[model samples]
Target chain A: MRTCLIVDDSRVVRTVARRILEELQFSSREAGDGQAALAACQEEIPDFVLLDWNMPVMNGLDFLRALRQLPSVRQPIVIFCTTENDINHIQQAIEAGADEYIMKPFASDVLQAKLVQVGLL
Target chain B: MQAADFQFLSALIKERSGIALSSDKTYLLENRLGPLAAQRRLNDIAGLVAQMRSVRDEELIRDVVEAMTTNESLFFRDGKPFELLRTVILPRIVAARPKERPLRIWSAACSSGQEAYSIAITLLEEEGLLAGRPVEIVATDIATSMLIKAKAGVYSQFEVQRGLPIRLLLKYFAQKGTNWEIAPRLRSMVSFRQHNMLGECAGLGRFDIVFCRNVLIYFDEPTKKGVIERIAQVLAPDGVLLLGAVETIIGLSTRLEIVPGAAGIYRPVGSGPRAAVA
Candidate 1:
């Protein structure tokens, strides 16, 4: 099965994302924040990452930058899932190597659509 | 069973439900009706046929027909049609409609109501764009059992797990023991009824969008043509018809034309009847 890492501070969000990803036949692991997510990626890179923008210790953009720099890490599909809906923020995330952006509190279908758009689904 | 017996059952199904069964479908008929025969205390399919010949058991016949009707369905079964609805069709319909005109959607052969529910969710999510426009979704099936399950809006865990996103599932369904029941809001959006495609549909009135998906493959050419003609009659001139991905009205109906840029979508021809309802 394809592996997915769900990086979100909220346990509920992570659980929900994981459930959806798993439904799409991907095995998933979760991290509460970007710092934990970076460490997890270091241990073993995942095929896909459902990353959230806001988190304690290390934010998503920082994690993405650090992740892209790691020689051990291969290219992985990264989707930003957050409440930040502004164009500027979204453009920034994309510039920082986010593969796609999905607004917070999106339905499973919407997430699935984004995955389809990114060719990860 | 003998060839005559197979012929008898196949003809009966065709007459009653417009479902064409070829000789190769003998296995399908036997497989589907085996348990029904056992339930009726018949020895086998031949015994079941003998019983049918002896008595006018309307209920038994209905059960046989229902058993043969395919109830296969999934929430958002295909992604493209729903995507077209979200991006292009809904927006165009919304823009073309006069203010306060109701949007009527019909889900024909709506097995177990998943397709209808999925449409309702799509509409509900677009409430902002609708700007308080009234939306009505009518879900219909030939089988009473399917309609019952649909009306109850209760689904097994396995059912919801198929093609249903967790976010919408959590939002619209509440746990009922091991199964999940659709939330009252989403449930209320759809009204389930029993309908036959071969029968007159005038009583159901007209619709802006009709989803008659995946049901036509069971029909022969004449039956398919007749059904499409009736569907066109009840469709608003600007209304769209959605068939199963592989199903088409190409040679069946001249009353409609395909919607460009989308597969399996059609609209009534220019000379067709005007809008029956908003």
Candidate 2:
């Protein structure tokens, strides 16, 4: 089973991902914001990351940029699961090093597809 | 004069392999073709082009292509794939197999044979399921000369030192003069041959693991699709197909799916779980 870390301010979003990941036999951990995510990343690196874009403390893009800069962290398949799906927005996440892109309110299959594309599935 | 020679080599490579060198790589063009010019008793690059164009000697054309082909490789090149293979792929396969049988591997487009030998050495040092199995690793390249050098299995100290850990170097290789030659048993495990990715690969058999990494970057879209399709046909249903990190089969062919987070690692089209299969 793969390991996934879901970072979102929304309790509902994190709960939903927890269910989906659990169903997929993925061990999961959650962080309410980017700072928590970064800390959890240091504690134990997950094989995949579901990073919400517009979060408090540090936004997803900043978090991703900083995450990539961390020497201890290896490259993990990360997706920007955000409400923002604009082409330029998607491109920004990619430039910041997201492995895949998925919009918010994504179905389980869409989440599955994103994970598969980056080799998490 | 240099301009005339540059275009000649570029056009030859384009026609021969369908790989168009951007007009800007004049230095590379000159460097790769300079030796061929000397061999033909030519004074300069222009004279060499004239000789090559005169007869269209297919044998000489093959020689030019072999000479021009990029032979860049290092031990433990792209270190992560080997890590994944040891910690992830090999054990999964060994457990899934029915009995203690020989496992098969093919390193398609195995340039200068570093990738194949890396895999071999990794298996030799590996613990658990892969430790005991008899593995036949077929390493094929498009360049006959490269295959010959690969068959020699000798490396200068510098070449051996890179990508290879000191511990492994002490264990797997023996010093001959200033060079290191792979142990005979390890050398026997890898069979090197010439293989063209764009041509018929029907003669080559199937493999449980295929490492065609970084090879398709040189091919056009059609050639890439054709080569990948042919490999898909020969890859075992449960096998792994590794491509370069930036490369993907996306929107090209649906037969293989990404093995998420493993970079370009792919599973045979429909073999993985529903999550993996689109």
Q: Which candidate has the highest DockQ of all?
A: 1
Question: Which portions of model 1 miss their true places by more than 4 Å?
Answer: A1-40, A49-119, B271-278
TM-score for each of the candidates: 0.75, 0.66
Tell me what fraction of the real C-alpha contacts between chains A and B each candidate also makes.
0.00, 0.00
**Pairs of residues at least 3 apart in sequence or in different chains that clash in candidate 2:** A118-B260, A118-B261, A119-B259, A119-B260, A119-B261, A120-B260, B255-B269
Q: What TM-score does prediction 2 earn? A: 0.66
Q: Supply candidate 1's per-residue lDDT for B44.
A: 94
How far out, in Å, is residue B270 in model 1? Answer: 2.6
* Window of ten residues with lowest summed lDDT in model 1 chain B: B269-278
Model 2, span B151-243: residue lDDT tens: 999987556644665446556777776567888878998998888887777678878888888887777787788888998888888888888
lDDT of 1 by residue, B157-244 (tens): 5677566655576668877665778989998999888899899998898898999999999999999999999998898878889999
Docking quality class, candidate 2: incorrect
Name the candidate that leads on lDDT: 1
Off by over 4 Å in 2: A1-121, B1-8, B274-278
